[model samples]
Structures are given as structure tokens and as C-alpha cells.
Target: MGEFDLIARYFTRPVRRAALGVGDDCALLSVTPGMQLAVSSDMLVEGRHFFADVDPAHLGHKALAVNLSDLAACGARPLAFTLALALPRVDAPWLQAFADGLLRLADAHQCELVGGDTTQGPLNLCVTVFGEVPTGQALLRSGARVGDDIYVSGTPGEARLALDALRGRLALPPAALQQLRPRLEQPTPRVALGLALRGVASSAIDVSDGLLGDLGHILKASGVGACVDATVATNLLAASAQQAVATADFGAQTLMQCALAGGDDYELVFTAPPAQQAAVQAAAQASGTRATRIGRVEPAPGLRVVDGQGQPVAQHFASFDHFA
Candidate 1:
């Protein structure tokens, strides 16, 4: 089938308003009168992002989730998305499952799948999502100031643990394994929480890379520095340590490494000024998401990690790099 025919037949279904839908060079969307568009894009490749044997449905869900996570970081309400998909072959069942998974998340987030193109090529998927924020009010990486509190939503390292399980390096119970499996496949994008954080967060970015690495983006962008409390930062590791002391497979040090350097958690990493701290906490509670104050922004422009005693701790910068 032709490219346009494929999109019409498979990708384009009835969605929300579209002044100009598929079949044109561009789709025209009307934004809320007082809102500005917040746009973000993410791309996933078969080998780099997921194993070749990984479920196509999960891959599709993640392809959209990552982009949606970006909108969350900006505290934007999702509007629509355009997808560019490349595949080696047309597998009917695979396509159906993939679309089902993607649509499920889209419907949940109230994001419309506006338009897209499909082509025969290497297995790759790219999605660009559009969201809306009141003009001049979207959270930005540059808004952070010294003494702002740093926060991260949800837990980290689950996706990396799922990867470990997939590679056979980690042994988990069937139920635990199944639980971890979703981290690799269907990541929960912090959409509602992100929108709730709009007036509270001074700066934000989704943690696609590890916490340290992703936090560095904010530090660099805001022209500031930070010192994370190692004890608090490694809390997950401490818990795992207690569990592993009896089991002996996972170690505190190892878990700490994973929490520090593991990537793809897709949680929101944000900064808020002291004045907004109470509001931030309230918003997170209202959204039913845990927002941990992991660190504090500093005036100096070098990022550092410290123990409870304020001594600097050495950390290896390890996380996902598309090129590396």
C-alpha cells in the first residue's frame, strides 16, 4: 500500500479537533486562546532502545511515553502527537498490539494521535508531542535559582533492573519479574502530576537518563550547581542492602550504583524555590505522586554529591548515551 494509504488505514482514526488532518503536508491544530504550545520529540531504535525480541506493543507504548514525559517535565497538558514509524515488515498482529498499547496511554492522557507516516526501513519509531501551557508560565530548565529545592518523582532504577532481568543477570520471582517487566515496556509518564506542578516548579526535566546525569542538565541549563545528600539519594540502595543481606545477590553498593547511574525512569526531576516548597508538596500529594527532595541548587556552577557530614562523595557518571 502507498504511504498515505497506510496512514489512513492504520494510523488515522477519529481523534479530537483538527483543522487540517492527515493527507496534507502539515496538520493544523487550534490551541487554547491563552496557551502556548509546548513541543517535544523522542526517537527509539530497536537495538538501542529495546531488544529485537522485545514485544512490539511495549515498544510502541514507550515510543510515545518518552515524548509525553517531556511534556510532563514542562508541566504541559498534552494535546496531540505526530508519529514517524519505520519497520522492516508489516506484521498484522504486531501492529495491532502496538497500536493498542499506544492508544491506551493516549486515551488515558487525553492526548490525540493527530497524524503520522509509516515507511519501510530499519526498525525505528519517532514521536513528537504537542502540549499547552499558559503563556510565559511553562516550567523551564533555566528557571532554577540558587537555593531551590531539587525534587524527583516516583522511584528510579526499575527500568534498569528490568533490563538486568532481561539479560539474565538478575534472578527474580515470577511475580517480581512480571512487575519489573512493565518498567521496561510500559513506563508511566508523569502527565497529571506535571500539569499540577505548573505554578510550583521553577525548573524541570524528565529523568530519561540517571538521576545524576539528568540533574546535571538542570544544573547546566540554569547556570547553577547542586549538592545531593548521599544518604537520602541512596535510600533505595539502603533498603535493597537490607534485603540483599539475607539473599546475597544484590548488594548495597551495586544498588546504589544502579540508582545513581541507571536511566529510563521517565520520572520528573524538578527544582522549586523555597517559597513554593509547600505548594509543590501539596500539588504532588494531590496528584498521588511521591516527590522527593533529593538535593538543593547552589549558586556555584559545579554539581557535587555529599554525605550527611558534607564531605564530597565520588560518583561515576554513567547513564544512557545514544551515541555511546
Candidate 2:
């Protein structure tokens, strides 16, 4: 089919008043009057983002979700998006499922799919998401300060573990496999909670390149350092410890490695002043999302992971590298 046929068949649809809806070079949106646009772009490449055989529907969800996660890091509310898709051929079934997944997220988040280009090439998807936050109020990596508490949302490393299972490094029960597949394939973008954090979080970034590496972005941007207690940050592994140990497995350590270095978690990592800690906690509780304090910002200018006795561990940058 042709471009116009594809648009009418899948993308064009009615949207809420906040979004002017499709059919333009750019989408028109009305945000809170004085806010500035908060925009982010992400690209997903086949074989890198997913196996060639992975489900198209999940792939589509992830391409958009990752971009939305970037906007969330800036505490921006969803406005609209543009998608640029490159495919080897126009497989109707694949396009249908992909569009279904994209529309599902757009409708839920109230973002209209405005415009994009389609071309002949290896499979790749790029999405640019638009959002808005009050002027001078967008949460940024540079705003972290000494004495700020570092926090992360939801559990980490599950996606990486899912990858391990996919690669046959470990065996997962059918139920566990089903549970992890969605997380590995399609992650939820924490938009509402992130927008709720505006004015509350001092600095923010999503865990796109694992916790340690992504946190390093905040440290570098803020011109500060951090000391993360791996003990606390690795607590999520405790939940699976029984099963891991019972199976005579190193699953716990694997999970830790994944949490520390695996990209694609897409959960938010943020800092807040100690004084606002209570307020941040209350907000997360109200939203029914778990936000855990995993570390603290320091005046020194290096990233360090310390043991209980405050001794430093050997560290190496172990996250995803786009050009590696």
C-alpha cells in the first residue's frame, strides 16, 4: 500500500482537545500556558533493540515507550509524537500489529501520532516525543546537588534477566517466562508519575543505560559525585534469592549485574533534596508506585560504589554502548 493508505488505515484518528490530532507537519498542542516544550528522540534498530524474530507489536510499543521515557525524565507531560519507520517491505500483518501497539500507548497517554516518514531500508523505528513542563522547571540531570537523595522507580534488572533467559543462559518456568517477556519486550513509560514529580525532583533521568551508567550522566551533568550503597540498591534481588539459591544458581548476582549495567529498564532515577524526601515518598505512595532511595549525592566529583565498611569496589563501565 501507499503512505496515505497507511495513514488512513492506522494512524489517523480523533484525539482529545489537548491534542489537535494528525494531518499536519507538526501536531498542535495546548499545554499549561507558560510551559516550554520538552522533547526527546530515540531510535531502535533491529538486531540491536530486538532479535529479528521478535514480535512486531512489542517492538512498536518499545520504540515509543523509550522516547516517552526520555520526556518523563524531564518531568514533561505527553503532548504528541512523530514516528519515522524504515522497513524492508510493507508486510500488512506486521504493520497492523505495530500500529496497534503504538496507538494503544498514544491513546492511553493522550499523545497524538502527528507525522513521520516511511522508507525502504533495514527495519528501524525512530520516535520523537513532545511534552511540556513549566518554563525553567524541567527536571534535568544538572540539578543534582550534594546531600540530595538518589531514588529509583520500580524494580531494575528484570529486562536484562529476560534477555539472559532469551539467550539460554538460564531456564525460566513458563509462567515466569510469560511474566518477563512483556518487560523485556515492552516496558511501561512512567509518564504520570514523572509529570507528578515536577517541582519535587531536583534532578532526573531514566535508567536507559543501567542504573550506574545512567546515574553517571546525572553526576557529570550536575558536576557532582555519588556513593551508591549497592546493598540497598540490590535489594530487589532478595525477592528471588530463595529460588535462585534453591536452584544452586547465581541468579541473584546476575540480576545485580543486570540492574547495575543492563540498559532498557526505562524506570526513572532521580534526586530530591532531603527536605523534600517525605513529600516525594508521599507522592509516590499516592501514585501507587514504589520509589526507593538507593544512594546519596556527594560533593566529590566521581562515581563510586561502596561496600558496608565504605570500601570501594572495582568498577568498570558496563552498560549498553550504541557504537560498540
Off by over 4 Å in 1: 1-5, 237-248
Off by over 4 Å in 2: 18-21, 29-32, 240-248, 315-317
Q: Estimate the overall C-alpha local distance difference test score of candidate 2.
A: 0.82
Clashing pairs in 2: none
Q: Per-residue lDDT tens digits of candidate 2, residues 258-296?
A: 767777888999999999988888868876778999889
Task: State the TM-score for model 1.
Answer: 0.93
Give the TM-scores of the predictions, in the order they appear: 0.93, 0.93
